[model samples]
Target chain A: GAGVSQTPSNKVTEKGKYVELRCDPISGHTALYWYRQSLGQGPEFLIYFQGTGAADDSGLPNDRFFAVRPEGSVSTLKIQRTERGDSAVYLCASSLELAGGGNTQYFGPGTRLTVL
Target chain B: AQSVSQHNHHVILSEAASLELGCNYSYGGTVNLFWYVQYPGQHLQLLLKYFSGDPLVKGIKGFEAEFIKSKFSFNLRKPSVQWSDTAEYFCAVSGYSGAGSYQLTFGKGTKLSVIP
Candidate 1:
């Protein structure tokens, strides 16, 4: 039983560069979510996908942040022109069905992105 | 403008001590509550959750949470804690928007340190 997993456990990039973080959800999970965690803070919602379409993207801070889950099982969070403030741990989670009150989300060991 | 609050920022206790972590959320309508634990280098794991039915919900590893609708709180408790329970605890809430999509809003986690 493989849990949700993220690629590049740690990534260091320049302030003005672009970065793409990938996530592989647990087998059979139909819903995926992206979140960001800053130092001393809890995770903040970024985006959510149900199947192949994004059900909610309101949590995304700005247009510079975009995510896609074309295949419904894997997702990628792309950041354009990264900033120092964007340095944080990017987390991914997935559930067996569309996220509601009862479904439990399984998280991945987040990918820590450091902008220098 | 939904928000979750964790009253304690850090808690240190000895093994076998009773543990309780406070969580309160502010939202206008029906909500789903969850408690997640993150060990030193591991991913976030679901400790417990409360949806509709019983106010008292039990989760894995002897953890439990009680949801009080009137108080807008979902507090996590464990009668006796072990050193292994030391980790960061997060409280999250998701409002039922009726659109079939719910995004989690998490609190500024509480770091628990259990000494053996």
Candidate 2:
């Protein structure tokens, strides 16, 4: 089976521009999550989706950052007025189901977003 | 309100040497613990997890972690290491929110270098 995958392995954009990152989770996975990893740091949670609805979005830094999983399979993270501070690796993960405390998330090769 | 801590930022060891990476978390409720590894230029991979029952959990590549509830710790260990083990190891914790959702909090990763 194909693992989780992300498009545009690398993206370079000017500050204040709009950017969108895509993610394709594994087949049959109903829980999807988004994270951001900065240099020399661990991944920071951004958002999580259960089915077609976002279960928890408290991790989102601000209103400029939004994500959607319209069909409950693929997800897209959108950033409006991107800032240089937003430059980091965007990661996506998915799991078989939301099992309270036992679900194991499989991650994708992150999309490195560079904001100049 | 939830946070994870990785005591070691970097470690160097030789082949056949024992390995230990310290991890501690601060959360008031029941939590799930995990260890993830990311090789250079590779996606993050799950090494192990602890949900319940046994405190000691084993993972792939001869890795293991012991969950100590009283100490609020889940430390990763291996009897011997190989050159291939050089990578970044992350400690993450997900708390059961009682609302059917789990959000992960990751620590600053530890970079392990194994000399051949």
Candidate 3:
């Protein structure tokens, strides 16, 4: 079985541009999450989806960040008006959505976004 | 709000030396604790987790952690570390919030530099 994967391993964009990061979770995982990691810092939670709906999105920094998983398989994280402060590695993770199940997330190779 | 603390931001150790990385979390109600690791250029991988029962948990690569509820601590330990073990370690906590959602809150991360 393939692990979780993200596309466009590296992306460079100018400030105020828009970028989208894609994540393909493992087959049958019903839970997906996004996170951001800055240099010398740990990953910060961004948002989470359970099935086709976002169950938790409070971690999203602002309205400029949005994500969708319409078919309940793949997820895309979209960032609008990217700022230099937005430069960081974006990470995606997934896990089974079992009731009372302790979520053990499996991560994908992050997309390093550089806002110049 | 939930939070995690990694007491050591960076630690240096020699090969075969005993290793311990401290972690503490603050959250109310039921919780899940996790230790994740990232090798150079690699995605984050689960080292172990503690949800319920058995305070002592063992994970891959000769790693283990003891969960002490009273102290709100889950510390990672390895008796003999290899140079390959040099990497970053993260401690995270997850608990249910309102709206039937849960999000992982992570610490600042600990960078372990193992010298061979």
Candidate achieving the largest DockQ: 2
Candidate models: Cα lDDT each = 0.91, 0.94, 0.92
* Residues B14-92, model 1: lDDT tens digits: 9999999999999988888999999998899988888889999999999999999889999999999999999999999
Error of 2 at B26 (Å): 0.6
DockQ of each: 0.77, 0.78, 0.73
For all predicted structures, in order, the TM-scores are 0.96, 0.97, 0.97
C-alpha lDDT of residue B42 in model 1: 88
**Model 2 off-target regions past 4 Å?**
B98-100
Tell me the TM-score of candidate 2's A chain: 0.98
Which clashing pairs does model 1 show? none
Q: How close is chain B to the truth by TM-score, in each candidate?
A: 0.95, 0.96, 0.97
- For candidate 3, lDDT tens digit of each residue in A9-87? 9999999999999999999998899999999888998988989999889888999999999999999999999999999
Candidate 3 interface RMSD, angstroms, 1 decimal? 1.4
Worst 10 residues of 2 chain B by lDDT: B96-105
Better of 1 and 3 by DockQ: 1
